[model samples]
Target: MMSKSNKMLDVQAMDTSSNTVLSVRHLKTYFYPDDGSVRKAVDDVSFDVQRGRICCLIGESGSGKSATAMSIINLVDRPGKVTGGNVLFGGRDLLTLDTKQLRTVRGASIGMIFQEPMHSLDPVFTIGEQIVETILAHEDVPRVEAAERAVTWLKRVELPNPEAIMTAYPHELSGGMLQRAMIAIALCCGPKLLIADEPTTALDVTVQAQILRLLVRLKDEIGLSILLITHDLGVVAETADDVLVMYDGHIVERGPVEAVFDRPQHPYTKALLLTRPIIGQKLRRLPTLHEVMREVDDGEIAQPKDWSTLATTVQTDGDKGEAHSTDANGNDHDSTPILTVRHLSKYFERVHGLKGEGNVKKAVDDVSFDVHRGETVGLVGESGSGKTTTGQTVLRLHSKTAGEVLFDGIDVFALNNRKLAKLRTRMQYVFQDPYSALNPRLKIGFAIGEALLHHKLATKRDVMDKVVETLELCGMDSSCVNRYPHEFSGGQRQRIVIARAMALQPEFVVADEPVSALDVSIQAEIINLFSELQHRKNVSFLFISHDLSVVEHICSSILVMHHGRITERGTVDDVFNHPKDDYTKSLLDSIPASNPKYRKIGR
Candidate 1:
């Protein structure tokens, strides 16, 4: 009898047919850094993508998902080498192909959509120029014809006003529009296989739904094979035909979507599914990866801790305090509001159509709301709906075009430069991208302590001590202080960013999409950290994000914005359960269902 490993290989080998568009066998990609140690980014990864099927690779960050994708097309950057294995497609081994030969197959046969469209697309070129160039590169078409085809592709992707979009640069379009454009460019060549890496990771729910639907349509209409790499289990459940669970550069589990979701065998897979925030189910505290698994001497083991005990401990600690106190409408009627906005409006002057005629754009139009002390108020909307602007304006990051902001009963707009500078210590803003928010050159320790020193909150001798304390509060330790931002992972960098914000012990914090880019496991930890901070410091938060589920989990109340105006406001229970506004209803509907059996079919 054949060995078990040989039997598995035989099963995969038999899958070769016209139905199988691509096959990766025992592929290994290793990165050799200057430290003389080798990192196995992708080790012995094997999978097959069937024609007209969506195969999703699901895992947390640094799980070798992207490395596997890159290795398949021989696109692994330097310092990283594909040392072994074969990628078979079209009767050819892609790994053995020369650079010139691979170039012919990359765009004409296999297309890829990167995670960040802004970085993937050329900044100086018009959207139309980029799309037309992509078409021209693969086909023997005239420039004029290519331009027309580009417009058609944009329209095919459901972008409105294709003509205007053709003329607009990448920066001029919204996040949804840019993502649609990236899809248009990738599919224009009509490739057999398309690789999409975290395509909807940064988008709002409504836009994400549209993009997912568009991909399904393309797959059905063109018989396209898609290899999707993402950390979102919800998306995987909704879109994938087959699931491949990756962990620490290994394929731990593989099966049909329904099978994997309904009865996950791997402990990592089970932990990932549980970490996501379910829309209707509200827990006292979200379960994290550490609670679901523990590390062993050889590797990690699945040992789920008892949640009841944890919940009881949290309740007995009495850390919730006034933060959990609310009436039927989710309003703390007895507590005074800490921050208030009255008739706030912000505008920008734009010159359009080469006429130099000034046009006023209202980013925040007469927005008014109040944030009570020790409460989290969610500001949610699609891109360009003014959620970020409202947060920034409240913090006075941007000068208001009209209206007034009162913090602690003092008019914020009436303050002079000196007074405003002094007040910054009391208010802090946590930006969306932690990578951009932190200085790459500065050590994380200095980054967190700079504010403490500049504001005279700590002396040089005690600044490091305060920094370490803040880091500990954010689940990091003193060792992180000596490291630069580049040395840490996305989740770790975010913790440092939060530490920097909390170091000042501000009364109020504006967190803009703080957990949007994180994996489900990391997102849970961050959400819990936010709750802990609120319980300990009684800090008020204006949490800005496009994800409704996350907002409903942590916030007491929510404010919905559209076209720079507040369209709805209510308690979390009232707003999410019985949303009155049509936009709010649509946002709620757009969230991907966590269970595959309940996934919505068709557009």
Candidate 2:
């Protein structure tokens, strides 16, 4: 029965000819855990990546999408082994090649760009040296010539200063620049097939747009076939010619990009598409994988409902926290603000190289914003634009150089450390990186209940019940309470972090990039949960992120920041439809729409 349950899903045949660049037939990769359990990571996955086309493998975490890519490259490490597969690359079976032959063909015939540049890049060596080594590995070139070719490839990827970037280490460059450098390294050998695993996952929307365009340009001009593995349907919609939907180690559906998106055949694909948030529309609750799988027995699957209609019912009375909130009597809404920041400013004293003189860098320059009672105020900008700093300063995590922060008409900046520490329970902070935000040593239950126990919000007898309740609210099971932070996946860890903050039952929360690491479906679930929590508990939120669609969905109003200043502020519809600032318009333009029938489809 277990083996039958692990059986592969039936996949449709591809409509490709003999010009395929990469083909995998009946691929099966299994992992042998110490507990005597077989984890079928990539089971019977088959597809063809045509020459000069992009085939996207998209799914949630642990869906075997990345495993399929790894199996093709024969990079499955440790107890995981590819038991059955045929990886046909350029008419040659890649699975039969030994290490010596695989190394020769790896960079020269098939290049790969990893998901995290920081991990893939060597901090000890310069960028140029690494690229030169990769080039020298494939070709018999001189050191000087190989270095020159590395610079040329960097320039081809549109880096502003290739020569300077060559000498710099990976830590010196920004996330986007490091990504470009990684691309340069991958393409330095001029491989025919390029495999990218979530290349633009960490980048901001604008930078992601640039990277996607670069990939497209390379595919067109260089005649490169790209196998792009990503969970972002928006990226797949804009970049992919063909789409492959993977679920639980199986290829559930496959078709052309538009055909697959406009009319998804499989239930998993339909659920994924529905989970993606529309820019203007809102949602009462996101559709989950359980809902989709349960309805598979039904003959026909209907199109997803327009969430805007259902969302209105929630906004009209349930989730309405406009410029005001409903009173405790459940009667009329009030217009009074909960938290207000007036002329906030934070500066860092930086020293010039070899010079001890201070160079003032204002991270948050005169940023003013307000969070109404039970309302969500979105703070959005590209990296280093002071979004996080503003939220941190308001929480008094950093010393405010100037300005007033008023919480319920009480000036918070004037409070001493002792007073501020006591008041922190009322204003909690959910950090950006859940991987680093959580304590590694604590159990999941203790981590969530720590605040409640510390602040005496609940007695010892009732704290466990409260913790379990909050965990359920965050969509986590009660069985996970005994698990450690390392035991959970990225999305699960993020939910646990939110549950930690929710346990405090604060009147206000500063959520910094809470859902950025999540997939579309998980992101929607967390965002909808935030809305429900706000409605039930009368909690205000400062939602900080570079994701515009998420901001528009959850936030009643948005505050646009650029160069450490508040450039524009308005309602979600007003700011999105009619923008006043140049940066605001640019940000809105950078947003990749998930609608498959867009004008620039598959550009």
TM-score for predicted model 1 compared with the true structure: 0.90
lDDT of 2 at 299: 34
Superposed on all Cα atoms, model 2 deviates from the true structure by an RMSD in Å of: 3.8
TM-score of each: 0.90, 0.92
Per-residue error for 278 in candidate 2, Å, reads 1.1
Question: Model 2, 158-271: lDDT tens per residue?
Answer: 998999989999999999999999999999888989999999999999999888888989999899999999999889888998888888898888888878877776667776
- After TM-score superposition, what is the CA distance of residue 542 in candidate 2 from its true location, in Å? 0.4
Q: What is the lDDT of residue 531 in candidate 1?
A: 80
Q: CA lDDT, every prediction?
A: 0.85, 0.83
Cα distance off (Å), candidate 1, residue 185: 2.6
